[model samples]
Target: MIGEMKAQQEEIELLLSAFDRLVEIPDEERVVFRTLIERKTIPAQSHFVLIGEPTADIGFCLSGLFRLYYTTPDGIEYNKNFCGKNEFIAAYSSLLMKEPAYFSIQALMDSELLVVPFRNFETLFDRHACWEKLGRKIAEGMFISKERRERELLMLSAEERYRLFLGRYQHLENRIPQYQIAAYLGITPVALSRIRRRLT
Candidate 1:
């Protein structure tokens, strides 16, 4: 374990703690696991990995945000998920399979990350039963998240969706464009404008 790296991330300790729970490892074990990790940072708008590209690594954010999105035939990008600071962000299926990714991961903010290749990760994770729990957690989370998105799209009114969005991401209302919110909520931008007007 690299003690120096741990010392350097004093500001993002909470992030590490959250990951520790997901991976079901103690801080000490995590540090040992992290000793072999590679560190990197990228600016916003940079693609971390692109669709159909081979992915061998998994990454976790220490700070900043990430967007995992895919483009349609018409070249429209619908965000699949936003990986926030401290969260794990990886094309897990591809990385684990050593195959091409289905979606692209991009930095939405200036980002810092810890990366580990599939081989190294497999070595550590396969050795610990607890590490397998992380994979289950990720899978289960993806399922629940899909359900929530479906419910919001099919059930919520445009205004209600806008309100829910503001409740969860108050500042993001400004950081994110109204059009993007409209796309996420499956509404027209004009409808979003009306919702915003009603709120104000």
Candidate 2:
């Protein structure tokens, strides 16, 4: 039990360090943040959030990978984004609108996450200016990522997008399935294969 507690403390410190990189989190605030966190392990292929469910927590990936995707009525799934270690994942739209999530966040690998209720963060925002700034910065980053993704989908060729994907997720290529990569690039696996052959 002591060992487990020590491990959890280390994880909280790592999360606080990551947050410190974005904005200074004072020691007192860090303590409060620590109190809000719950360590969770999601098995590979399991979901952190499911479509049509209200999302209540935001997760910071401690290890492993996750994919955020939307499924069509006919049962086709499209990858919207991937979250890797040291990154945040959440059903942002659902949290913002107080509605059920339109998509799901699934673990691509057995994953460890530092989870916190979104309401807890909101409470912190009211307590400290630093928390408010952190929230704003995080939102801004999410918006920029969304806009860039939209632009890539609208203006770039599949081949061009594939190149960009290779650059952005070079570390993840071997870790993820080709079919999912193709999904993210808005192409089929066959198309991705052709593109890869052409590149080589």
**On residues 1-200, what C-alpha lDDT tens digit does candidate 2 reach at each position?**
99999999998888888778889988789878888999999999999999999899988999999999999999988999999999989998789788999999999999999999998889999888999998887888899999999999999999999899989999999999999999898889999999999999
Candidate No. with top TM-score: 2
* Model 1 per-residue lDDT tens digits across residues 1-200: 68966655663455457666676576566666656677778798787889988877777787777777777878877667677666777887777667898889988778888776767767766667766776678768777876887788689887887788788667666766677677666667898888888878
TM-score of each: 0.82, 0.97
- How far off is residue 192 in model 2, in Å? 0.9
Off by over 4 Å in 1: 1-15, 23-28
TM-score of 1: 0.82
lDDT of candidate 2 at residue 99, scale 0 to 100: 97
Against the unseen true structure, what C-alpha lDDT does each candidate score? 0.74, 0.92
